[model samples]
Target chain A: MGMMKHLMVRSRRRSLWMMHFCLGGCNGCSIEIMAALTPMYDLERFGILNTGNPKHTDVLLVGGSVNHRNRRTLKNLIDQIPAPRLIVAVGTCALTGGIFNEAYNIIGGANRVVDVDVYVPGCPPKPEAVIDGILSGLDKFEQ
Target chain B: MTVSVIPVGPQHPVFLEPFQLKLVVEDEVVSEALPRFGYVHRGLEALVVSKDFRQMTRVAERICGICSAIHGMTYCRAIEKLLGITPPPRAQMLRLVWSELHRMHSHLLWLGLFAEAMGFESLFMQIFRIRETVMDILEQTTGNRVIISVNVIGGVRRDLDAEGADGIRRALKKVAGDLERIRPVLVDDYSVRKRTEEKGILAKERAYELGAVGPVLRASGISQDIRRTGYGAYGELDFEPVVESGGDCQARCKVRYRELFQSMDLIRSGLDRLSDGEIQTKSKEKPEGEILVRSEQPRGEVVYYIRADGSKHLQRLRIRTPTFANMAALMDLLPGLDLADVPLVTLSLDPCIACTER
Candidate 1:
């Protein structure tokens, strides 16, 4: 178990391929995630690559809120991702479902569906804040 | 050739948001395409009952990040109409400037994504790098990069000083210059043309019938623009809709590229016409009537329907986003196209699923 923890720690700091899932929120957080991937923020410097496939993803970067319709799909995506995966919930919606939390269809935040490793809060968190949240998630894994 | 079903999205790399497209294919050609919505449906319209009309502007802004400014402006416009109040001349001009800036950023973001769809990595990077300048300017002015909540009921919450206005002018100038260099690349470049030309042809009549808004309609040789409705400061500005004849992916790209320059010109003119005045007014009266307000978003025309019952909260708030109107065109455009062209065609419409579903 100790050796497995050390291996997980080493792998966490390396290239982390992220699969982004948008359950149901505004496009604000999704665009901010895109910005983080682009030249200015360049999240690639931290060895974070945005991938489309859930199976290969080390981190699941979820945008938006989990609603009734997408609950099963969200669970499927989380189930698909390999173990020891970190889920970083971006934006206010992902953290606590933001404005739409009280809506009829919504099932609240990302944590409502699956355990969230980190929550980056903002109407749509800035690219810098998103990166900081990811870094902080990395720190959590180190322990 | 036997037909096989190919599913895309609900979560796909090509789509920045979640929505499914089920493509029925024979050989390599898509026979029929079925789009499934409700992926990003957060029931925002229902929130009107919970939150007051004043707070709904911010909620409306979160409908789509790319067109956030216009969403807020349109919501405010609806409220202003119901209250029978017009924002001060300076506030209107400021709205124009910010709206035009938002348009530029949105078009640039689309261009970058379009380039990515075409598999042009360097061009995508260049477009985004240029887009970052606009984001920076938005951040500096509105204090937030993506969802700038500048719009209030009667007027804007934030005011741009002379120095800030100068900064905007400089940024617009730089963006215009950069766009000038990238113009030929978008419109006439061989590889881009090879991929986009005549790929998804929505004829003029068909586009109108499908209710395609904004660049899609303009690209189909229709000069219909909501700006001509003369809402906000657009009435004061003199400009024509950027039109193209082809109605294909190429034409759509041309229309967006041309509109970028047009938005820059609008901003410059807005800045010139911008007068010194109060940014906002205290609203003593609660909204009492129902008003439907329309604004030209970057993707297309967005209609906001607000029903207020002589109270702080609205009885119903319905938003008809551009994507919701344009999705009908996709049903027409998707079939009979190559499987590989799906992303290009889908993205050409600039589907803001968040706005569409919300």
Candidate 2:
């Protein structure tokens, strides 16, 4: 990688800005994602910010499962995010659709639509597990 | 006059769930608001066909992560009624304890979010810091936070021993103390009142006509709490519905604030009533009839309707979540609000769209 490119990748690793998008399942994973941002787990200490705009995000943390209606929004968000970005499928619902996999109008997990770089597994994973998953996804981000 | 129609969600920074609100803005004031759903709809109610009634307990809980225990409890309560089986007294009391605990944590979660909604960022952090105590108590007792999986088909799946009981008491003491420190900022602070009071006011009669439930209705001076029906151990517990007459965002916030203490008291009394007995009463009998059960979740009243025909799977399972009931009231609140206050006022209703669309 070129010098400026290497510096950009290293700085992105230091401060990973994540944008959360809820797909199709319950609010469990979404709450957990918020919990990770709050005081006790303190994702801010790691220099991570939960951003609102897709263009400002370095990582996309998807909650819930993928379904017909929300898949379009998810793809739109993914298209807007700058590359060298990471896509993290948080919670079991986002991984393999958890319990909502077989429901009609449900198209399974986040992988059904986009490639998930990291998978956090739990019916709803703990904030600690969520942090770990996101950091690992940062490790897998390409230059 | 050029009125701009602004789309608020389905994926907005303000909401944790995917729900849309189309607000018609005239001169920076909202003249009309329309909501759209189906983004988070996973067809969970229909999943009762594939997953058996027993398995649907977990599925029911998944409808909303914040109020999962109550969802599972309401589902089990409906099935128990259908089969004509009653959970043991101790089991009922345990459910009351855990559910009350869930209520505390869920209210704290909302309070934190409500604080953030008004741009009180530091207060938001402080509130969530206190919420961790309640979550810890739940984790200590049930071995999980958020969706504890304590409720089951016949009865509760876990019991609180003496150590666990003491731990909860201590933790609740700390939660109460921490909440006390922040109570003034939440209730009496000039900035808080300035931001919340008289914003998005809903009248008592209108709230009733619109079918609002839980804190939203209670804030409008309707003291209708499903717990008043005395389901489970609520019959034995001594408490009153926390009601406020402001009928605005502040009143709704105050109602939930007061309920946090009520929940704490309920938990303490519920522990006092916890006598030694079998936690689970096994039932091999299949549920064969149709029945509906209502339980008060952290948000409001949740109704579970179950129809069965002597089979493992239910014929039909329908859920009427509190957020669904409050939609009309929400639409009613938006017309007079400024565009900036829209998120705050909508959050005051504590709309859990995941549960609604499910």
Candidate 3:
């Protein structure tokens, strides 16, 4: 697939860590994704590294809203995160379940389970819009 | 020699939310502890039967975004006392100066996540740079910055002129001079009192028989304060409920570092009694009965039980979160501890798992 998309954009521009999850929002997008790592939206300047280990993540971020007892634990944390991962999905309750989008034990956002790749809507999105939705999910590993 | 268990959280990175403790250890201590709440239960009080009572104060300020403006001012003081309405002393000194600037930006975002769970990375970047000057004076007076939808039911949707009360008295005098230079590293730092002195104790008659509220029942000495039940404008200010007799975890981090200078002296006496009338008062009628609205949140006493039913939906919207009564005193301070002090005594009971599973 085009030389495996330039080696996944040279290994996600050489360092992307990030692993926050939350599902079922209101920690204000996990404290604005831990205030985009303090010192004013530092996001580790760009090397990004908020990890909590989804097997040493590559980008999952996610915030909340995907109920039903955490939708199979958010699909077993997006199937153990390894495959050229990247989910992003920041605030406004993980993108769509903003005001608990008709809270019948929600299932509104975090793309109903996985395949997000970058959303970052606000209701609770500023850590400079979750570091611009993680630098636009680092330009989707250059498509 | 045996017993294992561990488990920490539903997604743990020393938790921001998504609870589940488990623990049980043996060699490294912890004898038992089990906490598990519905991961962010989004059934927001059953959406009070499809949102009403003025859209349930934005679903009671999204239940928990660090006490979203005191859960929309305790659900507009229980629908302004079930619509008796009286809020115009300049919107009760602008909701007591934005609920003491959301209790000094939720106690400097819980002292920068309890100094980054006691690792103390530069006192967690100087308590988040003095909590970004109380989130930039709550985003230049409630335009939005972590859900500051200035409470509205009878009064207060937003109004704090005079240059937003001199930008909240120059941002609470630069967050009370950077919380007085981190109050001697959160009180005589010998590495934050060797990881929160006497760890998780919680005694004072078991923090009032385990019904702990706010500052973990005033750090277990219990002077009791739902702002001494004065409700809005906290009976014209001059407050006092910051007690501590060492119910441990460094007397709940010295009663949230002396209530962050007593919420900057109750927002400098609600900005010297800021006056000049009306902020919003036109609720004709719709709310009917049952009420129970208590406040004092910054992890404590947040009750809000409304029953209203004269019209626009709200038959029952109970809330009760001060981390669900401090999660039964965090299951009585997790057995004994030392599974590496279990994330510093479960983050010294500042557990707001989306306001205790919403």
In the order shown, the candidates' DockQ scores are 0.79, 0.82, 0.27
State model 2's lDDT.
Answer: 0.90
Task: Please give the RMSD of candidate 3 to the true structure.
Answer: 20.9
How good is the docking of model 3, by CAPRI class? acceptable
Chain A of model 1, TM-score against the native?
0.91
Top candidate on TM-score is 2
- lDDT tens digits, residue span B1-358, model 1: 7789999978888899989999999997999899888878888889877888888888889888899999999999999888888889999999999988899889999999999998888898889999999999999999998899999988998999988989998888888888888878888888889999999999999999988998999999999899999999899889999999999999999999889889988998899888988988667898988788899999899998888899888898999999999999988999999999999999998888988998
Question: Which 10 consecutive residues of model 3 chain B have the lowest summed lDDT?
Answer: B229-238
Residue pairs in clash, model 1: none
Residue-by-residue lDDT tens digits, candidate 3, B184-288: 888897878988898888888887887888887788787888887777777877678999888888888888878888888888877887778778788779889
Alpha-carbon DockQ of candidate 2 = 0.82
DockQ of 1: 0.79
Name the fnat for model 1. Answer: 0.79
Per-model interface RMSD values are: 1.0, 0.9, 7.0
Candidate 2 residue lDDT tens string, A1-143: 69888887788888988889988878888888888888999999888998888999988899889888998989988999988789989988899988999999799999989998888898788899999998887766454
Report the candidate with higher lDDT, 1 versus 2. Answer: 2
lDDT of 2 at B294: 96
Residue B15 lDDT (model 3): 81
Q: Write the per-residue lDDT of candidate 3 for residues A1-143, one digit (tens) a residue.
A: 98887886876866899888888887787887787788877788788888787888888888878888877877887788786778888887778887878878887888877789788888887888788777767776775
